[model samples]
Target chain A: MIGIVGGLGPYGGLDITKKIIDETAARSDQEHLPLLLFSCPNLISDRTAYLLDKSNVNPGKAIAAILRQLEMAGATIAAIPSNTAHAEPIFSVVQDERARMGSTLKLLHIVYETVRFVDENYPDTTVGILSTAGEQICSLYREAFIRKGFVVVEPEGSQQEKVNNAIYDEDYGIKAQPVPIANKAREDLLLVMDDLKKKGAQVIILGCAELPLAIPERDYNGMIVIDPNRILARALVHSLAPDKLKPL
Target chain B: MIGIVGGLGPYGGLDITKKIIDETAARSDQEHLPLLLFSCPNLISDRTAYLLDKSNVNPGKAIAAILRQLEMAGATIAAIPSNTAHAEPIFSVVQDERARMGSTLKLLHIVYETVRFVDENYPDTTVGILSTAGEQICSLYREAFIRKGFVVVEPEGSQQEKVNNAIYDEDYGIKAQPVPIANKAREDLLLVMDDLKKKGAQVIILGCAELPLAIPERDYNGMIVIDPNRILARALVHSLAPDKLKPL
Candidate 1:
C-alpha cells in the first residue's frame, strides 16, 4: 500500500498519488490498486519556514505519526510524496518508525527515482529544473541531476522571486485566481526550458511538483516537458509490474 | 487511509492498492492519499468451493477486521477492491462492521459504481458484459445496467463455459501464450461486443477484472472496449475530486 505525507504547500502531493495510480493502472493487466489518503495541511509549516529558520518545525514527527498509523493499518510500503522531505533528519524519522513497528515499509524517494528515470530513459538529455526558491537555493535537484550526467538549468534571481511571491501570496488563495502567478511561473519555466533546449535538452524536467500546476501542458518551443511527478509515477508502476513495464 | 480486504488472490490486494496510488499521483493538483492495504487472500475461499456450495467463506468477518483496523488507524472511509465478494452476506457483513466499530467507513460497491459510470457517461449506449458465470448468470451487471436504461449482452451457454475454462485451466497458466481456450473467451467477448454494436452499443464493459488479462486491448470490431477496472479507477479519481471530472 502507498502512504503519503503531504501538506507542503505548492508541492501538490495528491497530484503525485494520482499520477502514480493512473500510470500503473494504464500499464497493468491486473486488479486496480486501492488507496488511503491522509492530508495534513496543518501538520507542518510552509516551505518558507525552512528558508527563514525562525522556528524549527520538525516535519519528522508528523511524518512519523502518519507512517506509524499507515503501518498499523497494514500498509506494506509507504511513500512521502514530497521531494523536500527526503532531507536527512526527516528521512531518518521514517526509517525509525518502520523499525519501531517491526515492519518492512519502504519509503520511496521521489527525487532519487526521478533521477534514475531520466538516466535510464532520456540519457544525455539536458534538464531544466523549475521549483521553489527553498528547493533551488538548497540545491535539491542540482547535485542529483549533475551526477546523472545532465545539465540542470534554473531561473534568474528576479524570476525566482516572482515564482516564490506567487506561491506564498495569501491573496491568490483568497481570490482563487492563480492565473497571474501561474503565468509568471510558467514564463520562468519556459525561459529555463528554452535555454536548456539550446544546450541540447530534448526533455525538460519539472523538478518541482507545483511547477506543473503553473504550466500544465504548455509546449516549450517544441521541447518535451517531463514532470518529475509523472516520472515518479512511471517508476512506481514499473516497480509494481516489471513484466508490463518492460516494453514501455 | 485506504483499507483493503484482500487475499482474493495472493496479489490482488497489493495490485489494487498500487493502482490507487498510481492514479492519485497522476493528478494535476491534489495531495496523495495515504493507503492501508490489508491483504489476507487466505481469508477468501476457492471459487470452486463457493460455486459448489460445499464450503462457506466469511467475507463479512474478513471485511470487518479490515475496517476495524483502518478505523483504529484513522481512516475515515474504506473500499474493497474485490469485485465478486460484494454478493449476499458480504454486504451485510460490511454494514455490521461499520455498526460495530461505531465508525462511518464508506465501503464502495464496485459493481454499483461501474453501473453508475456507464449510465452517466455512456447514457443511451448499449453495453457488452463479460464476466464470470456467477456474475453473468446471477444477473449482476444486467440488473444494474437495465435499471439504468442500457442494453446488456452476454455470451451463450457453450461460449460461457469456454470463457470459464480459459480462466481456470492449469495448462493455460503454465504456458502464458494465448491458447485456443483463451482465444475462445476473447472471441466470445468480441461476439457479444459485435452484436451489441449492431444493436447500437458504443462501448463494451469488461465486467470481470480477469478478462482484461485474457484479452489485452482486443479490438471488438471498432467498438470501444471499456475495462470496468479502469472505469472504477476513474470513478475513484472523480469521487476524490468531483470538480476535476471533465465532460466526456
Candidate 2:
C-alpha cells in the first residue's frame, strides 16, 4: 500500500498519485493497486515565500499528520510529491513521523528516486533541464547529473526569464483561456530545447513540474524528454513489490 | 549529501553514479558533488539467477551493508540504482540501516521521484512504457500512472520477447560487437512505439534501464521519450538542495 503526502500543490500531488497508479504494472491475478491517501493543507506557497522573503507557514507538520493517517489506514509506504518541501527542516518532520510509525511504513524521497531512475536508464546522455530559476541556479539537476556523468544543459539569460514568467504569471494556471505570456514561455522552452539538441543533448528533462505544462510532449523534436513524476511512479511500484516484478 | 548505494552489478553501479554527476546542474561557485559510497560484492548474475534460480545470494543483505557504510560515512541521503534489488526484504534491510544510523539518513526510492517529476511536468498525457517482462507483467508503472490520470501503454507478447532478447542476448551487453538479435529488439520496440502513438500515446517511457540501450533518441520518431534513470538523477539534485536550484 502506498500513502502519498501531497497537496503542496493540489494538482501536483494528485497528478503524481494518479501517475503511479496508471503506470504500475499488474499481474493477471495480483494487480498492484496502492492504497492512496492524500492531504492538501492550506500552507504558504513556496514561490510566494521565496520571492517575498516572508514568514511562510511550513507544511511539514501537515504532511506528517497525513502520513500518520495513511499509516492508520494501512499504507505501508509513503512519499511526498512536493519538491520544495524536501528542505532539511521540512523533511525532518516527515522523518520523525516515520520513526514514530515504527518500521511498518517506508518514507520514500521524491528526488532520490528521480535521480536513480536517470542513472539506471540514461547513462552518459546529455540532458537539457527546464526548471525554476531557483532549481536551475542552485545546482539541483546540475549537481546530481554531473556526478553521474550526464551533461546538464540550461537555458540562458532572457530565455530563462521567459520560463519564469510562464510559471509565476498570475494567469498561468487559470485553466480556461490561454495567456500570451505563458505562450511565450512555451516558445522560449522550444528555443532552448533546439539549442540543446544542436549541442547533442539526447534527452531534455523537465526539471520543474510547471515547465511540462508549457512544453507538451507533442511539441518536442526527436529528443527524449523526461518528466520525473512518471519515473517515480514506476519506482514506487517496484519498491512495493520487488519479487512480484521478476522478468520472464 | 547524496550517497549512492551501488555496485550491485559491478560496472553498472559505477556507470550509473558517473551519469548522475555528469547530468546534474553545476555552477562556478556551487557544485553538486554527492558523497558516493559503493560495494561490489560479486554474485551469480541476475540473468543466471533468474534463469537457473539456484543462487545462494542475498541481495537484501548486500544493499543493507552498503546503506550502513554510507550512513557511517555521514551521508544524509541515499539511493540504490538496481531495479531488482528493491524487493521488500531488501528494502526492509535498508530501513533497518536507517534506523540504526540514528534515523538521520533518508533512503530515497527511485520510482517515487520518477512519478513526482512526471506529475509536476506533464499533467494530462498518455504515456507508453517499454520494460522487462518482470516490470510489465508485474504492473509496476500501470497502476501508479492510472491513479495519477496518465494513460499507460505496454508492448504485446512478441514485442515483449524482442525487448527481452535485445537485452539478454549473448552478443549485446556481454559481447563487444552489435548483433542481429539486438537490432531485432530495437526494431520491435519501434513498431510497438508506432502502435502506441496511433493509440494516442504522447510519450514513450523507457521503463527498463536496459531498454534505453536498445532505442536511441536519434532514430526515434517525434514522440517524447522518457528515461527513468535521468529523471532519478535530477530528482536527487532537487532532494539535496531545493533552495539552491534557482534558474540563472
Candidate 1 off by > 4 Å: A1-59, A74-89, A92-248, B1-6, B10-30, B45-48, B133-138, B173-192, B195-201, B214-220, B246-248
Per-model B-chain TM-score: 0.80, 0.81
lDDT of 1 by residue, B1-248 (tens): 44556555424454465555445542322254544445444444444345457657655676677677766766555666656666655566668767877877666677888788767766888777766637532477788889888876766677566556555555552123333335655565556556667766677776665666656573567766766555555565566655544444
DockQ of each: 0.08, 0.02
DockQ of 1: 0.08
- Residues A55-107 of candidate 1 have per-residue lDDT tens digits of 57756667777777665655555666666666655666657766776766666
lDDT of each: 0.59, 0.60
Number of colliding residue pairs in each model: 39, 108
Candidate 2, residues A4-87, lDDT tens digits: the string is: 665455445545655654464443212435344343333323533543356455555666776776676557777776666665
Point out where model 2 deviates above 4 Å: A1-248, B28-30, B43-53, B100-102, B133-138, B172-182, B216-219, B243-248
